[model samples]
Target: MGRREIPLDPSAGPVQQLAHALRELRAKAGGPTYRAMAGRSVFSASSLAHAASGRALPSLPLALAYVEACGGDRQEWEARWEAAGRELARSPRDDDGADPPYRGLVCFGQADRELFFGRDDLVDRVVDLMGRRRFVALVGASGSGKSSLLRAGILPALRERPEGAPRLAAVRVTTPGGRHTSEHAARLTTVPAASTEDVLLVVDQFEEVFTLCPERDRFLDLLLTALDEHSRLRVVIAVRADFLGRCAQHPGLAAALRDATVVVGAMSAAELREAVVKPAANAGLIVERALTARIVEETVQEPGGLPLMSHALLETWRRRRGRALTEEMYEAAGGIRGAVATTAEDLFRRLTPSQAGTARRILLRLITPGEGTEDTRRPTDRAELDAASPETAAVLEQLVRARLLTLDGCRVDLAHEALISAWPRYRAWIDQERERLRLHRRLTDDARTWVEHDRDPDTLYRGSRLAAAADAFAGEARQALSSPEAAFLDAGTAARDHESRQTARAARRLRSLTIALSVLLFVALSASLLAWNQGRSSGPRPRFARSGPCLFPPRPTSPVKTALPGP
Candidate 1:
């Protein structure tokens, strides 16, 4: 539903107008969502989405199905379709394929600007604020449209610099994900055409520096240095508000944020309406008034629910009929609350058991266990996954295609943090392994650090620390570990056992030596007594002088004749 855009090239021909008219019927019918259409009609949602896609003329039966799903008169729409076809403008250009208005979990990109809506004010504020300041941190909750505002809004706005603005050099946008800082710097530091006015360097998803990057302190130092090295360099980082505290730990970032932070929040109802209606309208489609109100009301309740709203709209779009998204469609897609989870669970259950297990580990890697903090999505390297499973790429691609997981270049991450709470199975997994997961993450960090420090034996786990880690891996959730992590655990356990065995051997050697010395003393004492008896009268030779090493206690070598006088 989310992937289908409406009335592609709507005004071009009667066929296109017929498609446009079809969209309007659905709009009039309270914008029945495409999901609803699929549920109520014989056609699939994808089929329905494609029917109006303008790629190929839909079959008459399909057209009738579309009208029927929208609660329209089939006879009227059927006759109307024929009439439009009579003079149908056959412009070679077809609206065969179109993108959807709602991005779902996908962040708005430069190409998606035309459909990005509802954040005009936020976008303007960001550009205006960063236009003057050298450094500005844009903060917002997850799914608050922060990435969209930066990507679809500010970047284009900067490119469209207005009069009276000072701009000479280039604009460089990059993410500080571990893999790219050096590249970002190399590109960002280059002065374009001898102009030093300002180079706008945008680092989106700045939180990844902590959650995903291994070189946290080093990356931060490099970034801060870049910001300070030139006054003409303007740096803008779009980050989630939850990580603001982590950001503030750095003195330079803290000072910059003290006065130059812009926090994006939920939009008002009017803004939400604009968001819901404007994109479809722009595409020659109408949104039902009731649908708009319903989306706004449901979205506002979830604070940072824009992602969910977008996804729901996407689902609704798929189920959309003639010209509109309807309440029935939204309900069919499980409303705002159920849509994302439903989609995710469906994907999960369809996988084979082995692939499903691989997926769980893959997803668990995507999360950073919060010791005392909230668990959040972690960006992971595809290489780590590759080491774990040969099937990694295929599973990764499937989830990425499903939008449950996203793969950007070599990196992989869950599309949104909301997925953590939205999916029941995911929540259950986290609950069952909270403590163990924390330990697992810590062990992974320690192992990496150990390798970085030349694999020092001193850094290896020992004693209780070793036991706890081993015990954790032996637990039921051990399968959740990546291959390297499992190997690390196995290596550490081996080292511990080796150390314990060496200590045990040393203790045994010492015990044997003590027994040998005691026996030698007894023999020496007996020999001394024999010499004394042979040299002199065999009276109990005057007891040896008392000293620390008395040769032997005063005991007879032979049984005493007067022993226990007939007791």
Candidate 2:
């Protein structure tokens, strides 16, 4: 049998290098076609072909399968994969730091503990509240380091536990969102406490219960019940401060807020300085004194402005001429007010027009309704986007890793709602479609109600309401509607069109009746006039004045029965 030839790009970076190595293994096996390999292996033939295509790196499963099929050493291939990952991570970005010191839009994780600063007092207060109370609510403005404090500060502090202090056992962190509030609450209540000393349930983004989940009160009720049922479980919830009024509506949470609510506000000037100065110092970079003073002076009045400061620092670091941060770099990043928008807009403009359009759509999709009925961040699945287009897929990954969009598991979301209003481009996009989105939101709510009522059809949008939704459902917003909403709108539209046709038929019948009535009246008037004319001409002229028609005349009574007398 003849051997099939496959070309390789030798100097095309680590990805191509890995592809070359894979092809060599195949060549050693007499270069079997992808079809033959798929027949033997579990991986698909197209997947196998793409793995060796020298375009991008293959996933571990595909790579491992290829290595095994070609009989390469597993240990060696795994090591190569690790090396590729390292090289890819270190690959220089357009901004020059793929792993920048500052995180933009994304919250700091445990791994980013060192990078998280400025919330020392807030964290301590929360820790104190948690120490004294069984239930503690950490409420803060969005982008005010609520998640960072919980993950980086409180959790770590609890783990340290002052040695032999109730010995931390099982700790689970979850968000109450998207059809999982009950399940998440269940995790807290149904903990395996026998194996552990105490269970810690850290619920981050607790506001999601109200914003994303429908049975919010039910979930809250269940949570209160769980607290009563479980002794070892200590719960800590982090909710955005904007939703405090929403929290008050839930009696259990409102009662909990009677004492245990910890409000996190903007960090003081000194703290903001530490936040900016320390992270760079740890990263072995220095900020100019003038820059620090300028930042602190400008940021003092701006409440909940830590994100702006951090993002500006990140972009400034990217534009750093050397070890020292400069004034020009900060300006180029659009300064404090414009840093996030500037960077985001820059990323957007750099994309091809089509890809740029796709990016807009992806960002808009991340926006779900907020507690205050404003647009807020919603985690969307990455698979919802078409990965078939390599360009679109690449942009999705880029935006996410850039921290402009936050990705967790297979899901993705805007890191914060602040981005919606902070960025001019995003703000304009939202403003342009505000009316449409409003209608879409109403439709979504009504449709959900309809389903909750077992598709009761009355909740469906009809007439102008359906028309409005359909009109707004154009372009990208069209795809944003849930399946139920789209179905409701469709059914409503059909119903409205049918009603319109029936109305048109009724109008046509009324027009015909009106025309017949007018014709009968005209015929009656003509007959009456003819009878009077005959009487005036056949009978005497009443011996009146010589006029074409007698104005006033007397009739001869004796000649009234002329026909009868003749008979």
Candidate 3:
């Protein structure tokens, strides 16, 4: 039996009134113990008991979990919880100078675990899989909170080390890029192997291996080899679902993932509510029920919308009233659909013409247009931009400051893939120049391959392809080309022109030979006709000499007349 709880005075305050209502709810349902309540919800027994303690307002998730376990109407309890939070916010306490609990465009990390909610069940499942498997694939759509699940959810849970689990010597998180190698994989496992303790290596954005990495096969082979050789090494890869087929192309990875894959899908209504309201409550702020309802309504139907919801909540928090995040602020910030667009467009409109152009180039460079999959963020090198230009530098800095882009070391990438579909202006830019962007991407890859082959002439473009590339990259568009790509195009153009000049010279020589042959033939035919005419004249002289004896011929003709009369 549970300990007897103190009765709450309904008239005391909002918190007390809420506690009294919960008690009455329990009574109406024939009063289950906190242990029984915990079995039905994702909360602890003590957490269920604390909701009715009346010492403070319970978090919306906790209150809802309590109500649901007790067979009470969740919508009614959620409203009551929001009211109590508002009353508590109105009554001031000493300021602790806490930072905003909500993460904007960025994902939740281990540091933000206290404010992270809504994936408890998912975390447990992943952690359990990790206990039995050496390789686990966490696949999800873009903006579906897979990264957060890995970092904030699974990382924290692993650190806590449930019951008999082995202690991790190290946890390293890396995103595969253009230059990954076997050596990189060796480095990740070195420490754990030496210490004879398990290590967790999380490969986030694993799709980059296909999109960006040139040594993807070598890298993948090394990771699989490490797992096979080292019993202490564990690998967790978070990849977009669209890349699952790509992973299947690798036989070793396919075998490992057949049974060791965890798929993150859309959040349920209850989960979404916890994701929206719990963070604000942790930061000592009230989220108006209307605002919560509006946010949930906007996000529930949108698949892979966690990032949009987080960004919207962050924007609303910025424009929050003294202690409450109201529906008015959410509307003002443009809600889930408009928040990212509003922020991006407003920044773009403030730039000068040249700066705006630079911004466009920078943003486009960070995106890799899709072939059969959705468009994704492309991590770029700082050296790829024209660092000499002040506008280029300024636009890059401003974008990083705005959190629309992220700068890590010499690499720059879009803050999230959600930005691709969320901002209309950026989407239009991609749509308008998608073909050109694809051409540029191919050129970039070809340039890298050319350098890899020591600039072999056979690798250079020729003929019609060269002509098309030259036309497409003419004028200002050429500035988008990297040094290697520009060099490649120039070499291809020069080679094609040289081939064309040689062809033209050969054509002229053939024309001259044909003219000479025709003249010789005409001369020979004229000579043969003259020879025949001279021969005929020399032979006819004897016949003409007999014409001098005309008189004798006349006498013969008279004698011949007498013979003709007899006939």
Best by lDDT: 3
Candidate 3 C-alpha lDDT tens digits along 1-567: 775898889887788999999988988888889899899999999989999998777888998998999899988878878777665543323234557778878888889999899999998899888887888999999999999999999999999998544568999988887765456766886664367677778899999888888888888876675357546778899999999999999898899898899999999889999998898888888999988887888898888889999988877776654688887677767789988997788689889998998899889988888889999899888877765577788999989866798888888888899999999899999998898898888888888788989999999998777788898899999977878889999999988889889989998998898898889888999899999998898874653357457555433334444444554
Model 1, 128-157: lDDT tens digits are 777566778889888888888888888887
Error of 2 at 260 (Å): 0.2
All candidates: TM-score: 0.74, 0.66, 0.73
Which pairs clash in the backbone of model 2?
none
Stretches of candidate 1 exceeding 4 Å from the true structure? 1-97, 163-168, 177-193, 225-230, 387-390, 450-459, 533-567
Which 10 consecutive positions of candidate 1 have the poorest summed lDDT? Answer: 86-95
Q: What is the lDDT of residue 30 in candidate 3?
A: 85
Off by over 4 Å in 3: 1-98, 164-166, 181-183, 191-193, 226-231, 452-454, 509-567
The window of 10 residues in a row where model 3 has the poorest summed lDDT is 88-97
What are the root-mean-square deviations of the candidates from the true structure over C-alphas? 13.2, 14.8, 16.3
What does the lDDT read for residue 330 in candidate 1? 72
**lDDT for each residue of candidate 2 in 229-299, tens digit (9 for 90 to 100):** 44667788998877888889767788877798887777788987888888888878898999999999877
Q: Over all chains combined, what TM-score does candidate 1 have?
A: 0.74
